[model samples]
Target chain A: MARKLLLEHAQVPGINTYEVYRKHGGYRSVEKALKTMSPDEVVDEVKKSGLRGRGGAGFPTGMKWSFLAKPEGVPRYLVCNADESEPGTFKDRYLMEKIPHLLVEGMITSSYALGANTSYIYIRGEYSWILFILEKAIAEAYANGWLGKNIQGSGYDLDLYVNIGGGAYICGEETALIESLEGKRGNPRIKPPFPAVKGLWQCPTVVNNVETIAAVVPIVNDGGEEYAKIGIGKSTGTKLISASGNINKPGVYEIEMNISVEEFIYSDEWCGGIKNGKKLKACVPGGSSVPILPHFLVCKTANGDTRMMTYESLADGGFATGSMLGSGGFIVYDEDQCIVRNTWNFARFYAHESCGQCSPCREGTGWMEKVLHRLEHGGGKMSDIDLLVDVAKKIEGNTICPLGDAAAWPVSAAIRHFREEFEWHVNDPKAAMERNYGLVNEKVNA
Target chain B: MPKVTIDGQTIEVAEGTTILNAARQIGGELVPPAMCYYSTLKGSGGKCRTCLVRVTKGSEKDPRPMPKLVASCQTMVMDGMEVASKSDPSVVDARAAVTEFLLINHPLDCPICDQAGECHLQDLAFEHGKSNTRYEFERRTFEKIDIGPYIKLHMTRCIMCFRCVFTAQQLCPERVHGIIHRGDHAEISTFIEKSIDSEFSGNVIDVCPVGALTDRTFRFKSRVWFLNPMDAHRDCPTCSGKAVVWMYGGEIYRVTARKDKYGEVHDFICNTCRFHTKEKGSWTIEGPRDLDRHSVISQNHYEHGEKTVR
Candidate 1:
């Protein structure tokens, strides 16, 4: 069994309640961090853990925490990014819904480490029921004296609030989330004055993913070195993979980083293989933003190395034959799936979610969607496929946010790996509209 | 001052000067077309990707070439930096692609449009647009709305440059208008259909680069090419009182805020100077030489004397 850190106690009956969570060794990290360690010490421990952010970017959590500018008389903030709206990713929602107290405990420890007197959980508005669950857990924490004035009599005061967003997918971006929290439109702010220097009412702030902050609990419980020893290479510590799509047992699973991709896919303990014994056609190992990998590439790298479920291994061949472990949104596709239709669906999502700030993303995403829609529905010319690639290439790096690149990658990768399929569609529009490309029944390495 | 090289021209600018402003200072054809950046607005760049430039060498501190093309309006120039705009084939292709994107859904009703002669989109499309677009899908359309008593909004023509939203937020005290919805359907909307009846609402009409926001008062007044702009001013307590009067056959058609060589309004003129001070008797009209070089009447109708309108 993969070493589970976050979901070890996920099956505990009353884990959502503070009393039950406390009985099962909750808030121990808070006590250890507040009483025994200084803020710098806590930060140093996180740095030593080698824990990269679980958010799509994979920035170093400790380095990001250290970058918070502590100016005189300015209140710093620790904002928990609970706006998990990335397509095919629902681990944060599952964690908050099942074990709400874990997040609360993690926030407390992280806020103390960052010297934050006030904190916020900027959750997506669609998660109203999860908001209630989080709020109830927060109330329970307050009642138990884990939050509020002088927590654990350590002379540190912290106040955590749950702010509901107007439900924008762009709000998942830290700057956009801060803008939304500030009662403004969720347009991404320009960087160079990153959130560390000026954010959330122009105060020094640290915006962290919910999983990144929650991992602080384990880093504090065990030493950073101990936590670092579990995962392979730079991707240390257990990660929550939100498995979906054609997988049989589709849900969130916490796996240590050392597991091989083949075992994780075929083993009964994890995704339990493809649904209805269908062969795996492709896999988006990370979230939808990362490139999709064909069945052969997903199991092994281009150099014939067995692909491990770690950041370094997954991104071995860059965007050519490898994909990133982005937010660990593992989506599997059976042979019956249509890559063109799936690409169109993602393009539509990006076009619908763009804040219309930058032209490349705002305009390019819509163009990709229109062209893909034409191709999928049988009105496409052969030149339209090249145009889709052209438009996607134009949008890749020209936008103000990563959303532009996210909208570009899937289309580019699909064209890279499956150009023949797209050509088939354009060559015979009538038959393409009537039926999908169907399953590729070739043997595994054929 | 930091010295930067742009298209073989080396110039020293202030430490935080952007490449767009630097190129604009060099003037003539070197000026990159910027659709979203208004010199008067504090935060009005980076939205429109029309100002992309390739930096061959990053700066003195980081000599590596930047990984990607940057928005010239947003990126500040550093010492020993090498930048390329119109001269670079990649930048030209990028600008052309952006121009295509801008015109994808635009209702090309230029004949009846009030801003045809002065429209930035029209000028850019002429400069960088392809003869035909590959996009054969349905264009996005929105119903024309009278957002305010003075401004008419045709949302379909809006490229989402966000200049109007920034103008309303910065100039209007009661900012009731903003972008609503998401993605391709995203549009500028007032809160709950409320009228954008702010004191500075008419300025949005001037700041808008497209015909999305047109002056309702001057909707069918006259083509901008036929109207002569005369420098005019008034001694009003509300604004700087300096403006330009658009005249046709000795009748004052409309009054708009005066702009410097850079096309930024010299002062945020009030509703009176913008809408009410339209009479020729309200202010002194300067000679025709004071009109901007880009103004349609400046290059087209130079034969017409000031007395021709008087």
Candidate 2:
């Protein structure tokens, strides 16, 4: 894939400082867009560029800006969704840790374009050090003419603040993020009046993922049409995936959309192949929340179509057969891994994480966890497999937000693709437990 | 108003009402079965799935629905929507499976539980669950982790739904519940290493979908059914909501968490409030007080006969 021109200066020394950033052509996009181009033209440019959200939803960036309800006499705000709590996804952490100025430049440009005078980055509470770096960077940007007042004489002002979350996975949901920003618990509000309508403080708001905002500086500098020419249609632009779990090179990688699932697995550029060259067993292509895809199905859809690593392609067969690009948390499992145990572990997470407000999710997540754990621990009977499926089905589409569905995907998918593994556990519980249960749990606890 | 048919009975309801909430509109109950539902819990679980009711007509997806049942907790009542919840055989089957699934992890600790007689699981099982389960598997167990100073851990009894977490966090974000495990063995744990020491911690005991999360203060205190519930202010004085304080022999035995018009509009003392009975009503009243004393200042002149219960 062609390394887009903007991300080249990302990892260099002094790149975090405002001076070095300026020397390497930083904030020029803000100058160009603010001084020369109309905000509408910028929105149109991003739309034409086919830049989708890099924050895992894969929504079009410009299109999302366009969706902002243009409420008059109200202070429109920009919220950089930096609550990167998805397990195994840490690409945003690396970017903020290494290149704070890049994100600052992007925030300035994106904020100016959206007519947002004030912006808040709702960062995860665990990233306090990252928050400190951002504060220092913000102070530095102010010291230079890059931030406050007329930036490079463009007659625009932007102020940024870091709002830390109180530790919630649901805050990744935009409204929840807004609620957390307002210093409240991060329960997602009902939609229809989306964040763009009545968001943070009941004002117009634009909540973009951190990478989604970081990608904006490039969109402004390179121009939308130029950026559009780079990636495939629909799944436009490059995505930063945090690939981890039983892989040769377990880290972050920036890959363009439309890469084949086969190549991403085999190529050293992403996961560097499964650990010890073990045959692949199953994969949760989009964080722990997306559906689990077996090796065979991960390579191709149920209709024998090869699956590509893109928003549209991966989700081609719908949720039953397809998985979402949520949070780009690619988790791969080796052939020796037990699907039942893995599914059980995920149930435990959902059950534990469930806010317990909604009954189906609260009770169902626990029920699913218990059943899955029971099945995995060799106490499962044949009827237990069906019971697991039934529990997952109950929680699939019920509850306040998509978190319920997220919790159900792995269980339902595991049962759908590997019901035999569950049955095997029922047939011989002790063997299954001794075979797949990892002793590393001791390591994890210790 | 849109006319809808529920279990062969037609009724008109306002637009955009949920079938569960709509069934509530038809007055009296319709033999409803639910393992994971509590209107006070904010959003419905739709998890225990005991609330499954077949939709025979009025929905496009399942026009010729047979054994197909949608969770009434989730599916909204629509115009001309036809539902069969009263006598749907599939509903019974689904509820049975839900009961069985819930039992897979239910500890034998219920005999010692304060929620025993009032537990929804016990009730749902009586209504639709099988007496004998073939699940001879070892129950998934987690060493006790305190959710709050007031609430005790028996994680083995926890279902991992986040009603307690939401209450904890929504009241005070940093001091709430968290999911510790992944997949089947996952559990809701506290983020900090400290004991679940939040003021809202006691709410977990009442909001818990199962026995996993229990109140240290109330657990093993008394059988829930035997206690009388009375409605009054969340006596925590700092909190809002019509408190549901259960009393036996003029002593507060237990308190079922409640969210009234006040608490829902603004989530506060429902957090750090200490609910207690300020005064007693006439002795003619039965078990448990589920009243809002603030609103009963004029109801049947009951306040005039108030006794010093506290």
Candidate 2 on B1-310: residue-level lDDT in tens? 7676887777888777777767866744463554455565565445545677877885544455533467676666766778888677766665666566667667857678665655556656655667686455577787876554566777777655555656666555465466554434656777754666555556666666557767665667776656666654533444554456667777766555554421221233343433333234412233344433222211334344755211
Q: What is the lDDT of candidate 1?
A: 0.88
The ten-residue window of minimal lDDT in model 1 chain A covers A437-446
Q: Give DockQ for candidates 1 onward, in order.
A: 0.71, 0.12
Report lDDT (Cα) of residue A97, candidate 1. Answer: 92
lDDT tens per residue, model 2, A187-260 = 67655468888998999899998888887778888887777776566777777878888789888778777688
lDDT of 1 by residue, B163-218 (tens): 88888889888778888887778889988778887777888888888899998889
Question: Runs in model 2 with CA error above 4 Å?
Answer: A268-277, A374-378, A428-446, B1-310
Residue A51, candidate 1: C-alpha displacement in angstroms? 0.2
The parts of candidate 1 lying over 4 Å away from their true place are A433-446, B289-310
Q: State each candidate's chain A TM-score.
A: 0.97, 0.94
What would the TM-score be for candidate 2 when compared with the true structure?
Answer: 0.70
